[model samples]
Target chain A: MDLVDFARGPALKAAFIIFILGIVWRIVNVLLLRHKRILSEPRRSVPVALLAGLKGTGSRSWPHPEFIKRTVTGEALGYSYHIGLFIVILLFAPHIIFFGSFIGARWPALPNSVVTIFAVITITLFVAVLARRLGHPVLRHLSNFDDFFSWFVVALLLVTGLMATAHVGAPYHTILGLHILSFDLLLIWYPFGKLMHAFYIFPTRAVDGYVMTRKGAPS
Target chain B: MNTSPVDFQANLAPEEAKLGESARVAGAMRGFAREIGALSALRLDACVHCGMCADACHFYIVTEDPQYTPVLKVEPFKQVFKREAGAFAPVFRWFGLKAKITGAELARWQHLLYDSCNLCGRCSLMCPMGIDIAELIEQARRGMFEAGLAPKELYEKAAHQRRTGQPEPSDEPYRDKLLAIGRRFNVEIPLDKPRAEVLLTVPRTDIEHYPAAVAALVRVMAHLKADCTFRSDGLVAENYGYYAGGRDWQREISRRLIDQAVACQAKVLIVPECGHAYSALRWEAAELMGKSLPFKVLHITEYLAEALEAGRLRLRTAQVGATAFHDPCQLVRKGGITAAPRQLLRAMGIEPRETVRHIGYNICCGGGGGVFDIERAATLRHRVVEEKFHEIDQTGAQTFLTTCSDCRRTFDDGKKRFNWELTPGSLLELVAEHLQGG
Candidate 1:
């Protein structure tokens, strides 16, 4: 990896620990959110509904699209931005060098020109979404404490990542330490905030799709 | 060629989804939201939105608008339920501080109920989901009624039905009219015959709006000479209040209808293809009336079919030109009398042609839910029934035969609007036509 050595002593250790712990915590929270009492309609053409990608043959498929479009792109930017950030994190030259120092692993890096362009596009999309959360009435209505809190963490990651790349902070060790510290905090907070939807989305959609199938109705 | 304009509103505020703010009936929308959410997942898990119902609808036949497609009508409820009770509630409740019962929204809702739907419940049959869009519309009507946003026509009709037990604008000579029609038709239509073998009841709409169906029914009975009669004391037989969403109103009107049957000691009762009337009477008749009906209840088609099947009566099939049958939303969909009317027509050697979505998933006549709002959107009602016009044209049928009075009026509109030389008549009318010279 032909980049800076940004991760110092404690910074490297905390980052790995948070990443491992946060992902596990999120899984637990989402699993507990299921509604148990309202049983499915009894064997009402289950085979037919399963084939239709529906749970059964009774409801109107109205709002699922709106929910996905808005939430996945709106409050879910916590996960979306973080995901983009994650790739950037792995590709960061100094972070790669640090990971190599610790685990003796190295992957190919994006040349400097492409890294800057990718960074610009990723940051621009993040900013546009952030402005939307603040600007759009519907999105504003959907924002709560957790929504903004999660986004704030993403903002911190972006700033630190930028500062490390620009070499605007302290020495190699100090800038690396700030970047790692912010990344670790985000990892730990990811599961508890709006970003938790990322882990829940695939499972929840699968549940929706499968239930639709079981009911033999269209979702 | 495109008689059915697909540009319609029922979901996602296609010009009518705005929430109202009314402090008086303030709790209606929220309460509505809660109740809707209460039933959302249950309802969602219940329907498999297959296009099977397409063949059962009148709107699809007339307009060919996919928006009139039955399952799509319930979209707004799904969206509201998802935001409130599904997974998106925390941020969406009371988002900007608006209340229920706004004059504007009430007006829009009236359009949705009266103009777009008739709550005929025909779609319930084709529903792999059996989701019951008619019931949901009834629920929404109830919500609007609670908000005091009910259409003036709905309220007025309900009030009349509540007091007089019919959908007449007034009940001044309702009993006299029944007697007059039966006598004028030259049928031995007995009046107040006690312990009659059957209590064949037609909607007050049949009497007020289209008296020919009642006259036709009486003539058919006279020809059969079946021991049955209409109870003058049970003057009005329609139950409009049920679809307005008040269980009490539903019961109040239902009790009167049943009371007449019991009082006359009729052995059996037949409901005409008035959708909500049938729903309020036959489906919930046992529960709402609290006492079991002493007689078997059937749609007019059912009893007539039985009469024809037993060889007690016969028709010569006088209707000419490729005529098609419009299944009343309730008769085929809710009451499950799909085959009775068609079978009756076929036995008469009519060889009835069908619209695209005939029988179980019939489109509404745009007259159920007391949508008999003549003052507002009268043309829209006729416009809504245009879906049936093209279907009738497709069948090359010059006659439109249906069992419900509302459907009869709608078919008439379909004829006038399309400038087609079509005649609109009821099944009993067809029976009367067959037995005209008998």
Candidate 2:
């Protein structure tokens, strides 16, 4: 089979299956594990706790005041790239087309140039994140195989996807196939790696906020 | 360096001295495996390894040591979870990618979990992913305890609590001390008063070293005309099992009070100004006992705040000068006693000044998590205290007010050792001293 045919037919189908099933498996495996019962009477009402948790999902995105003095650069870079990744993945015109084909859903996407700019920013920030991981002593010690590997995979996916869209480094059809293949690899790796944070962060932050707020702590 | 915090080292038997490294590793792994339930499993999985927690941890912020980073402290446990409990465990095992946990490795982890971490929960607060690093460390401590890798002071303290059901160093009956202090103050200290409205418990440290503070609590109880009693059976509030990371011992220590409160038919169980004591009772006791307590659990500050809020307790509105409130890690950050002390101070007509970091974000006094009792951690503890000392200094307050007795004692130690000018005092004591009428 030609590269384009293989990429579109079997490889994409496999990626789709793996992406869906892997995420389901991870969420189930984690959610189903038995937790110790919280026996203390919650200090506040359950609704208040839930509200606090909801508040925390947005509030925890920013660092505490003490850390804010020194962490503005890191925080800005992190938020910019994460937001960029979201736009490039869901709001890009090509991605919407792909989604329309798979799930029969449609939405307007950002202009191709805008998508390309986001891709460039994401790739640059990904490189900077890796540099910080390696150069900063604390980050270096905390960085593991999962961290570096996830960074590499996502960066490669963005670069290839941008190249496919911009018609650079190869013929458009060939670059698109390469981009699909790289994304397929990322899909298979997502649920098993640190990329699972995308799904887990909000729920975890909410639960923490709920508990803290129930105790009448500042959430 | 400093003398061993306890005498456990001198009495270490030959067999105890020579650790079975493999068995200890297995034991630690078993503890980890047992404790890795859904919530902990989720927390373990959520970490992005961004090292933002380092900024939150006073241990790392003060020392600038990468190893002391909060996230790094839990790295080994995360590896264990990935290899044994993760969805891709079989793949990890097939590739032989799992690092082997050894006894010596666990021995080193003892320092990270106990000495460096105060279980302050600040890292959990800082985490964008809400990874509960302090709770994870508390669980990891259980694994260390199971492996017999806990610090000597911790083990000894736990053993002492197991044997005596109290943390008092002396053989003197605590009842006698309470009675003598009550007699000196001419306050009727009721012992084993059945069906009392409140069951007041004191830490052994309060009875021995801070009897005046204990007297203040008694005087406050009397002034409120509350039906409170101090039971000789479970009077001590400090739970060394918590400090030692021994889950069974913690449960045992907590159970003594639970059973007593149940027997006395008390309406409120008053926890002393001991940090971990408040945590052990106000948070962990109910979980350990497998039920919500029949009686309400309140730290003295929480009780005072409630009374003031309810218009039950009246203060004389004495001006104590510019005072700064030190939020005890366990009491404020962990227990949510944030506004109570502030409210109590205001009730006394003292507008307390805020430290640079106050309430939930306050820095630890550098002697929590039983680090004060670990001689090996003395130097590091001293260094971290300097960070807090600077914060206290910035407030420019002459007197430091804290609710937890452990924080109070640590500040006293820091004040004496570092020649700090601020006076260390308890919030309850301040309130008692400024009561409207006695």
Candidate 3:
């Protein structure tokens, strides 16, 4: 089989299976672990606690006013790249068609040119993110192989996807096959690496918020 | 005013000396394994190493030291989780991706966890992934305590408190001290009164150095005409066990107060102006007991705020010049007692000039979590105090007040060290001074 056909057939199927099962296994492992019962009285009612949990998930997304001056650059960089990734992945016409095929439904998509602009900006932000990780003393000290590798995996997909779109590297089929292969690597690594934060972030935030709110201090 | 500096450090315990190196490491690992509940597991899995938590840590902000980063301080604990209990543990072991936590690493983190962190919860608020770095650091302290690697001063105090129901400088009986203070101040400090409406507690700091605060508490109870009493068995509001990460002792200390409240049939258990004490009884006591507490737990400020709001307690306006209120970390961020103190201040016709960061986000006084008792941490603690001094000074207030005795003590230390004019005053004492009909 040709590179594109193999990439779209067996490789893509294996990646999808691994991705779904790995995510489930990790999540269940965490959920089934020992959890201490909270016997303390909650300051707020159940409904209020739940509402606070939801609010916390959203509130923590932005820095508090006191922290903005020191944290705005990192926060901005993080938000900007995440928004760019969403546009490139979900709003681009070709990418939407690819994703929509699984659900048997199609939605309107952003024009290819608009998607390209977002993709380029995202790639730049990714570079800036790496630089910040390397340059900031605290970030540099805290980072590990998992962190750098996670960045590489996602950045590889973006770079190869851009190359395939602009026809800058090899033929279209070859570049597209490389992009799909990179995605397979990401799928395999997602559960084991820090990339699992995508699934864990909101839940963690909600749980923390609920806990603090129960103490009458919602962060 | 007890202007002389008192050494807060306590002697090391004999058991700590008996722990061998390898056994200490095993103990630490066991402690870390025990704390890996579902919530902690999720928080451990959620860290993205973004480093934004550093900005929220006063230790890192002042020192600019990468080692002081909140997340890095818990690295060894997180490493223990990844190797022993994580979802990918088997895979990580096969590939040797994560290493077993070693004694050397735990020794290095000893300073990071005990000396540097205040467990203030600020870093928890700053983490984008909601990792609760401060909580993890507390868990890390659990490991350190288990390994007998906790700071000697803090560990000794915890051990002493667990044994005697009070920490160091217990030269005389606690009841004797309370009676002396009552006699000295001419305030009625009723002891062990059955069926009292309120059971009040005091911190050793107040009893030893600031006895006026104890008198103020009684006078306020008298002014409200509330049936309140102090029990010798539960007189302490300080929890060295909570500060030192000895869970069993923490539970024991909390149980003393809980049992006293129950025995007296008190409807309310009022924690004095002690931050960690309020947290221990108000939030953690029930959790440790495996059931809800029988009586309501209120910080002294909260009780005062309620009385004023209900119009049962009236205060005559006093000409206390421009004042600033320092919110204690455990009280404001962890206990949610922010508004009560402010409300009490406003009721006395004094509007507090707020620091740059006040209320729930206020900076720690650099002495919470028992860091004040460690001699090695004094320099670092002083640097943080200097930063706080700047923040409070910027408000340009003549009088400074706080609700936590530890904060008051730390500020008092800072006053002596920096030769600053303002001595930290207690809100409870301020209230007692202005009681209209007293």
Candidate 4:
């Protein structure tokens, strides 16, 4: 088989299987671990506490007012790139067709030009994120191979997908094969690396919120 | 009140010195494994290393040092989780992606977990992933404690508290101290009263250093005609066990107060101006007991605020101008007693000039999490305190007030050390000074 055929067939199937199983394994490993019982009386009702947990997921998405001045650039860059990724991955036409094939569903997509604009902006933001991580003392100290590798995996997908769409560096099929292959790598790594934060972040925030809210202090 | 500083280092036990490095590493690993419950596991898994949490740490903010980053402090503990409990642990081990934690690392992290972190929950609030970095640091402390790597001062204090139900430097019995303060102030500090409505407790700091606060509490209770009593068996509100990460000792220390409150058949248990004490009881005590506390737990400020709101206690307006209130980290951020203290201040007819980051996001007093007693941490603690002093000064307030005795002591120490103009005052004492019809 040619590059695109190999990437689209066996490689895609294997990566998809690993992605799903890896996610389930990670989640179940965490879920089945020992959980501390909350024996303390909650200040709010169960419904209110649950609501606060849901609220926490959204509330922590932005910086608190006190931290905004110092954190606005990081917050803005993070939010901007995430929004860009969502638009490019979910709202783009070809991407929709690719994702739709798996879920057996289809949805309207943004124009290719609009998707390209978002992709460009996202790539720029990703670069800025890397620069910040390397330049900032705390970020530089906290970063590990997992952090930098995770950035490279995601950024590779973005850059290759853009190249495939623009027909810039190589032939169309070759660029498309590289894009699909980059995606497969991402799928394989998603559940093992920091990218799993996509699944873990909201729930962690919600749990913390639920706990603090029960103490009458919702984070 | 004894104004003299007690050397906590003098109380250290010699047993820990016997453990070899290998044994220490094994102990810390075991402790880390034990602490990794589903909630903490989830939190550990959720960190994206966005580094926003560094801005929220008082230590990192003050020192601008990457090593002081709150999340980095727990790296060794998190490393333990990833290697032993994570889903990809086998693969990670095979590839050497995550290495085994060592005794030397735990020793280095001892300062990060105990000296720098206040367990203030500020970084927890700031984390984009909502990782609860403070909670992880607390877990890290547990691991450090198991390794016998906890600062000698904190460990000794916890051991003393676990044994005697009070921390060190008490020359007399706690009951005598209470009785003496009551007699000196001409207020009745009802001790071990049967079937009281409220069970009151004091930190050793108040009984030994700030006795006026104890007197003030009694006067206020009398003015309100509330049936509150201090039980000698559970007189202490401080929990060095909680500070030092000795869970068993923490539970034992908390159990004394819980049992006392239950025995008195009190409806309310009021924690004094001790932030960690309040946190130990109000948040973690029930969990530690494996059951809910029988009575309601309220900070002294919360109880006072409730009384003021209900018209049971009245206070005359004071002329203390441009007063700035320091929100203790545990009481405000962790306990959610933010509004109560401000409400009491308002009840006393003073509008508090808030610090730059007041309420839930307030900075720690730098000496919290028992760092004040850790002699080696003195210089770093002072640096953190300098930042707090600058924040309070910027508000241009004449009187500085706080709700935690530890915060009070920190500020008092800072005042003496730096010759700062403002001496920290307690909200409870201020309330007593303004009692309208006592």
Model 2 agreement with the true structure over A6-95: per-residue lDDT tens digits: 887899889879988989988898888887888787788889999989988988887888778756766887898899899999999878
Each predicted complex: what DockQ? 0.04, 0.52, 0.56, 0.57
How would you encode candidate 4's per-residue C-alpha lDDT over A59-113 as one tens digit per residue? 8887788988878988899889999999999999998888898899999999999
Candidate 3 regions exceeding 4 Å error are B1-14
TM-score of chain A of 3: 0.97
After superposition, the stretches of candidate 2 with alpha carbons farther than 4 Å from their true spots are B1-19, B184-186
**Candidate 4 — which residues are off by over 4 angstroms?**
B1-13
Alpha-carbon RMSD to native, per candidate: 11.1, 3.5, 4.3, 4.3
Give per-residue CA lDDT, model 3, range A90-150, as digits (tens): 9988878888889988888998888999999999999999999999977887788888999
The fnat scores of all predictions, in order, read: 0.00, 0.69, 0.79, 0.83
Q: Model 4 - which docking category?
A: medium
lDDT top scorer: 4
lDDT of 4 at B196: 96
For residue B172, model 3's alpha carbon misses the true position, in angstroms, by: 1.3
Alpha-carbon shift of residue B311 in model 1 (angstroms) = 3.4
Residue-level error in angstroms, candidate 1, position B2:
30
User: Candidate 1 or 4, higher TM-score?
Assistant: 4
Tell me the tens digit of each residue's lDDT in model 1 across B1-438. Answer: 011123333222221233345542454555355345323344432332333343344454444444455544544444444344543344345573112234443444445554556776555433433445555666666655555545555665776678766655554678777777767766566777777777777777777777778877777777777788777656566766665555567778777767877877776777765655665676666755556667777777778888778877677756476668877665555555666777777877778887765555445666555655544556656666665566567888777777777667666665676775777777777777787346
Query: Lowest summed-lDDT stretch of 10 residues in model 2 chain B?
Result: B1-10
TM-score of chain B of each: 0.79, 0.94, 0.96, 0.95
Error of 1 at A169 (Å): 24
